[model samples]
Target: MDEIEVEAVDTLDPGVARDTAEYVLYGGKGGVGKTTMAAATALASANDGTATLVVSTDPAHSLSDTLEFDVPSRPARVREDAPLWAVEIDPDDALSQAGMFGQDGGFAGGLDSLLGGAAGDTAEDAAMMPGADEAAAMQLLLEYMDDERFDRVVVDTAPTGHTLRLLELPEVMDSMVGRLMQLRDRLGGMMEGLSGMFGGDDDATEEDQFGDLDAVKERVQRLRAVLTDPTRTDFRVVLVPEEMSVLEAQRLTDRLDEFGVPVGTVVVNRVMEPLADAVDVPDEAFVEPNPEGCEFCSRRWDVQQAALAEAQDLFREYDVKRVPLLADEVRGEQPLRVVAACLD
Candidate 1:
């Protein structure tokens, strides 16, 4: 495979900017610094005077700690610019408001009860209800897409498995139907009237016979346009300098191509570059505190450089950013700004 190398930027030029990035999503393997990177991107958007919401979809939320402030499960202001907001969406709320065939009657409460008759064949076998999270998260994104209030929506997403499902949802909606409730609703409502008015043609197909929400399908297609359009939505994948992380990022790019979601960039976080004019490591031996009990940070960096070579080989068509390791935990505005500078 061909390879092209890249250095992380301090400020990205408009030449590489997405023309209509109303929605941007960050996804990759767990523990790859996606939350911090996504927060920085959203912060930059806000600094540019666009109203932006950076939402965390990771089951283990890091946004509250990252911002060094309280972020509500609902959307809340995290800083000075009225333009920027932070939220960690409640997955339960997304399902209830998703209006699943109106079975829940659009009530924000009581979705589990409402899902009574809607649970299909595979739901029972799904481990810890994986499919439910996909539905709920997609519903949340769809709800936001329908609303005109927010200028930009930046998602700090769950890991690749569920995140892929969330992005491909609108494309796959055509197949999600066991039965088209919209079709049945229309045909049942005016069956007798339409049959008489249109002259009971014997060879008519179901689509020809339907009259309700002919416009609705088009609307869903339009929504799909925003998600799949290259210049509109950018999917950024986060990776580290490790074997599995590099391989996973390569696989995810293939999947995104299959689903037709454009990848704007690849963010490779936590690099340990040799110093040009700065303080060196105090000792040659491994001697740092292991907060998560990961004692070999230098060894991790060695593995990462090899992985970075692999990433460069895999994503030659796209931009790959290398974010250096931070001295302290990346919390609050200062660290986030540091990261934003690295994304250029």
Candidate 2:
């Protein structure tokens, strides 16, 4: 493979600035550096004096490792001098804490009592429902959006498939809530008749059960609105410099378009660029690739350039940013700052 010379141009744009959107979401296939990008963006936003909270929705939880800090299940300030916070949401814990399945068996128990079943069976069934964990995670996300303490929220979403499900959850959950409401109405007359015979008031219990459902529906609606609003949310798709990753990102963007979500940026991670040209650092930190002499480096560089061309053309309508392949693992604040500078 011959040394291929490609022009380097600054791709960052003000429209996709870190502080432009109140909620910024980074998502793509696994191992494409989505978590690192989210962390760097959040760090940059906070350093600029914006109160920013970075939340991780990935079940494999790497945000804490990437940030080099212990992130609790709930939002906590991670830096004393900066207005930055982080949270790694545990889906099951979020659901339990939200009282979706309380000791009194909130949603599940209520439905079981109305339909006549074992006390815990309904709760178990609800837990087993498809996308239940994602739904719970999204519920917590909605709460965080309503949180007035932070000026911005950046999300590190799960891998491709899980992310699609999480994005689709609002509509799925809304339909489920609507069905439950209809079922309650259908059983309303029967409940009134039974109350008259048994001399018991079920109205209060019914009201409480349906009231929670109504609240959930309202929250889901709000989430949908925020997701579709370009000024409020910016969904950025991250990908490596590879053919498969670029194809996956294209599909993800298409799905987002179908869902009416606004995708404002595409991030190409680990591009093969000279270390000196990529980031400013001490001389010791430089580890430029010898593609001209090494056969393996030359081949990999050629492959990456091909994929980069495809990605650029496919995502031409959106702002695209590239991060150079780093010699060290991007873990601590210093390295993250370097990545943030690349983003700028």
TM-scores of the models, in the order given = 0.72, 0.84
> How much does candidate 1 score in TM-score?
0.72
In model 1, where do residues sit more than 4 Å from their true spots? Answer: 1-20, 101-130, 178-220, 274-298
Candidate 2 residue-wise lDDT, 1-344, digit = tens: 43334334243221223568999999999999999999999998888888999999998899999999999999999999889999999987876655443423244545556566532433454444446567678879988988999999999999999998878777766775676556657666433322211123446465555566677778879999999999999999999999999999999999999999999989998887744544346544434567879999888877888998899899999988887787788998877877776676
Candidate 2 — which residues are off by over 4 angstroms?
A: 1-18, 101-129, 189-204, 275-279, 283-287
How far off is model 1, as Cα RMSD?
A: 8.8
Best by lDDT: 2
Global lDDT for candidate 1? Answer: 0.64
Residue-wise lDDT of candidate 1 within 249-271, one digit each (tens)?
98998898887888989888876
Pairs with steric clashes in candidate 2: none
lDDT of 2 at 68: 95
What C-alpha lDDT do the candidate models reach, one value each? 0.64, 0.78
